[model samples]
Target: MPILKFPPIESADEQGIVAIGGDLHVESLKLAYKKGIFPWPISEDYPLAWFSPNPRAVFDLNNIHIPKKLKKFINNCSYKITYNTAFERVIRKARDIHQNSIHGTWITEEVIAAYIQLFREGHAYSVEVWEDKELIGGLYGVCFGKFINGESMFHIKDNASKIALLSILSNIKRADIKYFDTQMITNVTGSLGAIEIERPDFLDYVANTTAEKEINFQNFSLHLDFDL
Candidate 1:
């Protein structure tokens, strides 16, 4: 399929639900994200529809709230947090968890392959949790400039994913990331301090920040100091 270009995204929403049919090619994925587009079709077999939603759910890394209990767990837990050490494993766990949920999963095989490619190219990253060398939970996302678009997260044990999130927030705090995009709103995200910004406000922020700075995830390592 031909790669879709930017500009069709409506001003009211800044969301261009562009090109409902295409493959998840590496070039296509990179181009899409570079222009603020992301794939979120309903299923693997459905046509690929890229979106830049209005009122995007975003968490200012500085604003993430680590609850007292979670903070305690992080402060004393023996589990270690690592970055990009097991991207595929994290993706598979997310898919498995989503499939078990009532909402089902959209992380198709095509999506998996596409993200793995993104990881290889240094645009995608994962935060992993290990206990006794066993992978328990993690989260993954695409990073562009000062923004990290959180895609999905899963946990095998209680608060495992929460630990991953706390770890991510800590890393972002240490790295000075300005925005953590959640794409959409949900209770899970809401609990983590994500908030909705009006479309215009979001677009303005994106425009002002995306090109002004660069973010390199390799400069930092995960720290499990949250009092989980």
Candidate 2:
């Protein structure tokens, strides 16, 4: 495992890039999250670039929205969900699925190894969605105290990724998490109730705040009201 170093978050350019060229070691990755920075590699050809975008995208736990159709899908579908049970698989699937959707993937082999180690040390978690005993959808990201930085997600079946998300939100209380961050706003996340807030606000939420998982993941379950 390589060590990672980053410049101060305040040093990030207008584009939110703070620094470059560090491998994603567990220590460095944890440090990055603590300081409101995350890596978004420019290309496989380039070194890792860290970012903490201003007007950061996040889901206000009090204002999260579950689209009607996805709610209906959850109500009608027969599927199983688990957390931290298959971290490596979930991350890899998210990476590959993302790669197919776009031209390239940022989940490089180095990134994968880094996150897998993070998971081992309990600095990361993943949500896995399964259909008929086959993995269909999942997502993974870093967990820093009361805040979570959602990295990526993918689904082979309609609404699979949404189900994974619901599982996370529904258990926030048990997890003691205060905010769920998507890192970047997109049509998908925006539809699912994510919003952009100033980086300082995000810093306030994560800085020095602490909330490790208090409940066993096996004991966690999604009890949906779906905000009809």
- Please identify model 2 stretches exceeding 4 Å from their true place: 1-5, 173-176, 211-216, 222-228
Q: lDDT tens string, model 2, 1-228?
A: 544556667888999988877677778888888878888877788878888999899887777788767777788888788788888888888888878775678888888998998888877889888888899998888776666767888899998888788677667645556578889888878897888999998888777553443235566774444332
Q: Give the Cα-based TM-score of candidate 1 against the true structure.
A: 0.88
Which regions of candidate 1 fall more than 4 Å away from where they truly are?
Answer: 11-19, 212-214, 226-228
Give Cα-based local distance difference scores for all models: 0.77, 0.78
Against the true structure, candidate 2 has what lDDT?
A: 0.78
Alpha-carbon TM-score of each model against the true structure: 0.88, 0.91
lDDT agreement of model 1 with the native: 0.77
The worst-scoring run of ten residues by lDDT in candidate 1 lies at 11-20
Q: What is candidate 2's CA lDDT for residue 144?
A: 61
lDDT of 1 by residue, 135-184 (tens): 98899998766657789999887788888877777777777666777888
